[model samples]
Target: TGKAYELDFNQIALDPVTGEEQGRRMWGEVSLSRENLMPFLYKLHYSMHIPEGFGIELGILLFGIVAIVWTLDCFIALWLSFPAWRGWRKSFAFRWKQGGYKLNFDLHRSGGVWIWGLLLILAVTSVSMNLNVQVTRPLVELFSPLTPSPFASRTPVSLDEQKFPGISRDEAVSLAAAEATRLGLEKPAGGVFYSPEFDVYGVGFYTAENDHGDGGLGNPWLYLDGQNGALAGTQIPGTGSAGDIFMQAQFPLHSGRILGMPGRILVSLLGLAVAMLSLTGIVIWAKKRRSRVLSDQRRRHAEPEMQAVS
Candidate 1:
């Protein structure tokens, strides 16, 4: 057993570093926000069932969901964050003057540290224009002069107000295309979708392009002129704007897919970790509750017999 090539049970290490670590691959290098760190990762957190580019309304909903998860994660995070919490009997809200300081502060700090990793992922990823890159890397190569986004401003078109019948869908689309070309946007990737509520046939365009012309590799937005085909102005998806490119990428980064498959996998893994930590914390709490109940019952049952001296 001295140094033979044959297998030796006690000679090996339990946890081995992966090939990635050997390659010196770091999340920070590709991340736009390399200042933070997260030890967890998950898949669904990187890719979800949600439709793409739904907008801020959906964003708020997502926020609510993650917040709830974070609160639950606190128990797990707190456990990992503060080993001393095991002995903490005070309120999670500590107050020095009232002698409640120890309890609250312990819970607060521990809970914060537990979710801090997740928070870093969320915060850093939300600002990237496209989630196609890592937080440490720019999603797309930045232009030196930083050309104005083609879809930045809308070209106005005069339309028939009372259905004057002068303008047709063809004219509207052609005008949109022309204006798009003029402003240097990729050919219109979207067509028209009429909304009854608005009474206007809006011209739409998806932003997906490999040539890297106007927007990034996402879907097209819209331009709503009148049925008379008068251009009100250029519009973007989810309230379209040249500024939207940067904004949309942020959500993906927060979810962790901005870098590619690896990033998505990492985010998904983190989600799983958060889920596991929550479940474990709940079980631990339940076990403690059961133990307390048994102890209370045993003590109460033995109480009356101990009154001998009195």
Candidate 2:
């Protein structure tokens, strides 16, 4: 960061003749280009050893999940409504006698039983979406650049002072991203702060949420080991592309977490279903218990008098 100044994209940034801004936008433009994208991705995934079309397949899988999640939603709704259907099995469930409405009775009670397990499975699996990916994926791709957040064995990481003597904001950001790739850091994201007075480069990495801070489950950042080409002691969680601070941030934006925004709204609806189902299930179970106890008491009272007389 530097003193705020207005910049013209067309003149200062895009124009070939503009010397200062040309290099700046060059990184920005290619930040997502086919030429440099894969390595930039490698820096994040930490590897690139997958089958030829694995990345494209992964994209397909991500798309496939949308349909899967939607299907899960329909099942969840069916499951939650099961208790109301089960009420039909009761003598006066649904405010009428199941004895008289046999077809209606089966519709409520049996239909719900069929979908209940399926709904529960979907809910649990959906929550595991990110967790499963996080816990297992990066390690699997430790040697594959296609994976997110894989670290390299010989990455330059150091804890020395005076390493980044003349490094500025841009240099610091580049070094952090480069080291992250070399060292196999996963899904790195952060901002760059520059100061001529400090004459040192500080590149902070974290989640897009801006929650990644020093030792706070925050994004890991590194102060350039100015003396040597290594990262200093700062490990924020998550990684993004290398090249430019502001530009690489876009991919992270697409990840639905720059704002700590929820991944998808599917889970939100699922949560509502869970709450409703839980409450209705408890009520139905309670009602069934009371009915069974009453019936037993009535039977015992009816048979006792005759036995005593005999």
Candidate 3:
């Protein structure tokens, strides 16, 4: 039901030099050469294609809850499937001699047991992101230092605040760059965004000097006051509070970017495994139902013959 951002021709336009901007045929008309499925997948995964905004929100909330509950169920199933010390070796092996149903059952059970940890991590993180549950914040806070407080510059300005003359974006960027070097941020400056809500310029950059230098999460950020080139604070991932690190890790982990290419491949394969498990489960149920129906039919036919003989 959802469409890609690139396909929203009404809201977007193409420029010869800078493509895809807000306007209609400013420089030249743009056309799609081929179909792109990334946007479709994104919308489907997030359940954002619902007719109305409220519907989309409701769908995400319900989905997050279901995922979390299902994750817990998977954990229970894995625990129940655990074999004794003597059976540990056999538990990992699949019996090829078994029939289709038995094999399916074993695959479902064994796969669940093997990948349950990853599934749980993904599920919990999904809940935290979609549901906005601060599960990690409290745990991290207990063990780590406090995160920097939000920007609170008392100096106020009118809504029509001038962008120039005070502190240019370039100045803010330079300060951020210097700060990054001092903090030993290995990655180059990611990018910068202007935040009107907080009247500050935010710069995002990555570093490989922290607890989770695996690059699975997003880069840390540096916040500077828009009015003047004053350093508000920096959210360096490597040196952040526990809560900050946890929050930072969510996006990368969710998208499989935290662990690089290998992590992405692993997550993709796990997704396929989940799909297979669901299909096999449905197949098993259907076969059982069909067998029950045949048994009932045979019993009804035999009942009349037995009565006549009696």
Candidate 4:
């Protein structure tokens, strides 16, 4: 299947070699294909190769918890960075002249302090992405009203009970295109997606090059009823309530695509910084622990000497 097809998800089943419409394939069959390396990696990043079983997505839940912990740790680390108000500058200063332990400590503490806001954003957005329904939506709703998500608002049917769309994919796209034009959106319909669980068709509008809707709140998506092809809901980025917009920004912010290429570069560097900080932290802990153990051993040896002398 070296032949490239259109970006429409509607034709996901189209055999590129034979030019025949094949039935829908499983996610692994498509995502794990030779041509879909990025998609496979993206899936691995969030899901960590965990398969869904027993009505639980363990990978998502575990990552969500980790994000929550990371979010709280950010605040704790910030507080620890400023132990004394007068010497607070030390927290942000790197001891470049003194290498080894001092430099490691400085990198771990100062590096984190320098990019604390970005770290917090990453942590919080991670939670939003991993646990939108379980945690983020509830928390956002506490402060601001959120427009109900079409996928979440509707009742989900089991795979066995899933109903086929009454309207064709082309019909759904046409309805979505009409809605996009009505709203004065200029971007063409870039992709079409169907949710079997919710029985909804989501039509995304953007340029081919900007499929992810990089830069500024991402792209607009229209959710249509699969049965009637009627507009069910709309997600026009940057055009909603405070809570709604915040919810929409989660994926873009998490992936650092909100600022486009520059943001992606920054996020990649930040990832390295995070890794460095974690390694330095472990080194610091090990050094301290070793020191404590040596001190305790010396004290024990001295106690025996003191007893002998007595």
Lowest-scoring 10 consecutive residues by lDDT in candidate 1? 34-43
TM-score of 1: 0.42
lDDT (tens digit, per residue) of candidate 2 on 1-310: 3333446331233453754544332222224665446544643331222322643444334433543564566566555555465564442234244443343433344434444554554533433342334432343345433322223221333333113355455566777888778776765646665323323345665566554331222455565544343554443344442312222232333233343445324434544554655555566667779999999999999898879889
TM-scores of all predicted structures: 0.42, 0.32, 0.68, 0.90
Give lDDT tens digits, candidate 3, residues 1-310. Answer: 2322344343234574867554532111232223334544565676544433652466576666777787688767766677576676555666669868878877777767677778777887777776653344455567775565445334444435533336777888898889878878767666677665567888777443532334446566778877786778777654666567777777678767688777778888988988987987788789999999999999999999999999
* Candidate RMSDs in order: 19.5, 17.8, 7.2, 5.2
CA deviation > 4 Å runs, candidate 1: 1-80, 83-115, 119-173, 187-192, 199-220, 226-247, 254-257
Better of 3 and 4 by lDDT: 4
User: What is the RMSD of candidate 2?
Assistant: 17.8
TM-score attained by model 4: 0.90
Name the top TM-score candidate.
4
Residue 255 error, candidate 4, Å: 1.3
Candidate 1 all-Cα RMSD: 19.5
Computed on alpha carbons, the lDDT of every model, listed in order, comes to 0.47, 0.46, 0.67, 0.88
Q: Residue by residue across 1-310, what tens digits does model 1's lDDT show?
A: 3332432221122334553322222331223332212311221233332343743334434544555465455456546554565655432333445534343444345444555666555644432322222222332334222223322333423232223334566776777776667656665555555443344555665443321222233334445445556555553433434344455455555545455556667777766765654565566577679999999999987787666545
- Count the clashes in each prediction: 42, 32, 1, 0
Candidate 4 weakest ten by summed lDDT: 2-11
lDDT of 2: 0.46
